[model samples]
Target: MTVLVTGGAGYIGSHMVHALVDSGERVVVLDNLSTGFAWALPAAATLVEGDTGDEVLVSRLIAEHAVEAIVHFAASIVVPDSVADPLGYYRNNTVNSRNVIACAVKGGVKRFVFSSTAAVYGNPDAVPVAEDAPLSPMSPYGSSKLMTEIMLRDAGLAHGLGHVILRYFNVAGADPQARTGQSTRNATHLIKVAVETALGLREKMAVFGTDYPTPDGTCVRDYIHVADLIAAHMDALRHLRGGGASATLNCGYGHGFSVLEVIETVKRVAGVDFPVELAPRRPGDPAAIVASSEKARALLGWQPRFDDLDTIVAHALAWQRKISAEGR
Candidate 1:
């Protein structure tokens, strides 16, 4: 049963490809290279350069590869850019997702793992947001993801699709084996931005806001390691394959870290103190957002080993340095 991994050439998706291929699972990757690179894809898995929105192409591939499950990761993910162009967000994130799910159902793909976001909670009042928190989204990107979650749920009712929606917090870090990492040209993720600054790829990066209600007066987030997040996906896939019912799980360490603290960690790990700029809070920026992963632990049996901020920083810095050495 080959797993169809959309956007399998991008940062986190590429790592998923590597994991799937290495674990003896046949994998077919369909990536458009919009924000992904062909070189990042592993040599073992089958790679098809295409779009998830192309129904004909996707359906053909599903038949050709005997695709049993899908790990959907293809979508635009910039928060601020989604604000500037709401329609673009809807077209790519919402509409394209509909096409992918349609193709999945038509092709008889039963297991699905949708990559969701913590943004669905929208400035949650609670320190660690639970699974049943509010569904208010503050950005078009968040709204787009939430809409897909709704689609998946409704799709499950009629069709016999076993689905898992993993709402992710701030995903950072790289492959522990250093095979593939976040290679976005201008990534807005906090850890990636700070890492690029440390590598001199950028002069400096700014803390989005500083006057929040938190003790540190900056946005705080539960920064989960990228590898751990991927582990949750694997567990979800296994559960669905084992005839488990549908579930929506939060993927995070259940601990919050300040932006300033993350910056200091990067400086400490890199041993270079780059200039930090204090800037006004960006719109749609939440004061603090953390996840309560108790459900994931009890349901999926997930335990995050690299939960430390420094470990996450170290892996990200290593990948950034690798990219810098290549002069990309």
Candidate 2:
């Protein structure tokens, strides 16, 4: 049985593709290439350039490929941009996801794994938020993902589809082998931005909001290595295939670091003191959002290997340098 991975050309999706192919799984990628690069995808996975909302195309691919599962990673993820274009966010994230889930049901796909975000928690009332925390999304991006989660839950009950929704915290780092990494130009991910700056690709980076309630006065986040995050998806897929019940799990290290702390690590790891400007807070940014990942550990038997902050930064820096050398 093949696994169809939507957005499989993007950063995290590309990593998922690598992991799946490494495990000897038949993989098919469906991507529009809006922000994802076709070169990021491995040659082993069949790349289908199309929108996930196109139900007819999706159904045909599922049928032809004998796809038994889907790992969906397609969505608009920028928080501030989502705030500026709430309707667009809803259409791309929620409405499109509904269409994909519909296609899965029609195609008789058994398992699904969704790439969700911790933004769904917004500014949680407490740190180390559990999976069952109240749904309070502060941005359209988060709200859009939460809406998709709701649809998956409802669809499972209505159609007997087993699914896993893994709500990820801040995902960073590259494939340990440097085969693929965050290759998107003008990307907004914190570690990406910092690595670019250190490599002289960018002059400097900004630290939004330095007066929050956190110790360093900047927003705090639980950063998980991209490899470890993909491992969680693999375990989730295995669980669903083995008749495990549907689950919504938080993917993180159960801790967090402030913005300033991450910047310091980047500088230390790269040995380049890139300039950073403290700027006003961006809209939809939470003060601090950590995770309680016990459920993922006990339920999926996921073991994170690269949980260190410096190691994550080093891997990201290595990828950035490689990109710079290749003139990409």
Candidate 3:
């Protein structure tokens, strides 16, 4: 049996592919290359350039690979982009996800691991938001993901598809060994922008909304290492394969750092200072939303090794340096 990973050429998705292949799991990747690179994938894993929204292609891959599980990560994830084009986000994130789930059910793929987001909480009423928190999405990206979660729930109940929905907080860092990282061009991630600025790849980075009511007047986020995030996905796969019931779990460190703190860490880690300009808040951004990841800890047995902020920044800096050296 093989694992079918959607968007496996993207940053986080690529990390998941590396981890899965390292564990000797047969892996098949489906990506459109819109924001993904084929070089990011390992030779051990096969890449099929395509879109996840194509049910016919997805179905064929499932049958050809004898796929037993799916680790989905394909979607448009930029919050501001989603806010500007809600319909596009809905079509790519929600409608495409529906197609994937339907293919999974029809293909007899029993296990599913969904990539979700904390944005679903949408300025959560309280800190350390748990899995049961209200689902008030502030952006179309979040709403699209929330809609998929609902679809997965219904599909799991009606089709007996064991699934795990991991609502990620802020996924940062590289593969820890510099094998893959956030290589997306014009990325909007806070840490990625800060690191690029420190590396002089960007003239300066903008700090979006310095009046978010955080301690430092910037948005606070729970930044988790990309490696750790991939491990959580592996755990989800194990849980579902072991006959565990369907579950929705939060993936974070249960704490957060303000945007200022993250930028400072990147500067210190890179031993450089770059200009930062404060700007108005981008639409669809939440002020602060941390994660109560105790469920993942207890349920998935998740143990995060690189929970330190400096460590995450160092790995990201290293990857940035690698890509710069290679002119990637």
TM-score of each: 0.99, 0.99, 0.99
Instruction: Kindly report which residue pairs in candidate 3 clash with one another.
Output: none
Model 1 vs truth, CA RMSD: 0.8
Model 2 regions lying over 4 Å from their true place = none
| 1 against 2, candidate with superior TM-score | 2
Candidate 1's residue-wise lDDT over 1-328, tens digit each? 7999998999889988888877899999999999998888788888899888899999999999999999999999998899999899989889999999999999999999999999999999787999899888999999999999999999988898889999999999999888889999989999999999988889989988889998889999899999998898888998999998999999999999899988989999999989999999887778899999999999888888899888999999888888779876
Candidate lDDT values, in order: 0.91, 0.95, 0.95
Where does candidate 3 have its weakest 10-residue lDDT segment? Answer: 207-216
Instruction: Order candidates by lDDT, high to low.
Output: 2, 3, 1
Error of 2 at 74 (Å): 0.5
Estimate, for each residue in 84-198, the C-alpha lDDT of model 3 and write its tens digit. Answer: 9999999999999999999999999999999999989999999999999999999999999999999999999999989999999999999888899999999999999999999
The model with the greater TM-score, 1 or 3, is 3
